[model samples]
Target: MIGVLVTFAQTGKFDRSTLAKIAGELRGPFEGMAGLRFKSFMLDEEGGQARNFYAWDDEEKARSFFTAELVEKVTGIYGAPPTIEYLDIVGFVDNSGT
Candidate 1:
């Protein structure tokens, strides 16, 4: 599995409520997405950052999804460009019973 960490530095450009609302509106499209194991939208208001963490069953699919176009689009959404990092997922636990 692969983990993708996408971070946006808000720097007072966005508030928690706005980021939450954006996450709510955008999450639906990720539901049932191919090669996606899990996705999380997170906020750190005190740190002025927003992050999206994704676990992918296929690294290629994950890489393809985060294209330059997508970066530009997300920049427009978050009011700043994001820093994306891909990591090797060495351990995972799922207790949700889905």
Candidate 2:
């Protein structure tokens, strides 16, 4: 699997509600994306940081979401640029109870 990780800095004005809005927008589109396996997000409010990890079936499928337009859509609200890292996911663990 291909993994895309993004580190974000939120706008000073963002509260929990603003974070929820950004999460909703990302989830809405990526959930329907072709070849997308799963996506998970994390936030450190005290540190003013957010991160998302997405697993995709292939590089192309992953790159589709890394475009400038999409980045703008998400980071624009924060008024900052996000740092992204793309890596090949060679292993994983899923412990969610069914």
Candidate 3:
């Protein structure tokens, strides 16, 4: 598995409501996306940051998804560029079925 962390440092550029609306609007497209295990949208209003954590079944798909065009589009939507980080997912625990 692979983990992609996308962070947007708002610095007062965007508000919580706007970010939440963006997340709500965008969630539908990712619902059954291929090669995506899960995607989480997070925000820290006090810290002035919004983050998205994506878990992918493979690195290739994850890498391919975050292209320049996608970044540009997201930047336009969020009103700021993001700092993207790819990480090796060593382990995880899923208790959803419990």
Predicted candidate 2 versus true structure: per-residue lDDT over 1-98, tens digit per residue: 89999888756634677667777876776667789888887776787887778888898888877899978876776567788899999998878865
Provide the lDDT at 39 for model 2: 85
Model 1 / residue 10 / CA error / Å: 2.4
lDDT of 2: 0.78
lDDT of 3 at 35: 97
Model 1, 1-98: lDDT tens per residue? Answer: 99999999965855778988998899999999999998999887777889899999978999999999999999999888999999999989898998
Rank the candidate models, highest lDDT first.
3, 1, 2
- The CA-based lDDT of model 1 is what? 0.91
Error of 2 at 5 (Å): 0.7
Q: Higher TM-score: candidate 1 or 2?
A: 1
Ranked by TM-score, top first: 1, 3, 2
Ten-residue segment with the worst summed lDDT in candidate 1?
Answer: 10-19
TM-scores, all candidates, are 0.93, 0.78, 0.93
TM-score, prediction 2: 0.78
Task: Flag clash pairs in model 1.
Answer: none
> Candidate 1: lDDT of 57?
93
For residues 4-33, could you state the per-residue lDDT of candidate 3 as single tens digits? 999999658557788789989999999999
The true-versus-predicted C-alpha distance at residue 28 of model 3, in Å, is: 1.3
Candidate 2 residue 81 C-alpha distance from true site, Å? 1.1
- What's the CA error at residue 42 for candidate 1, in Å? 0.2
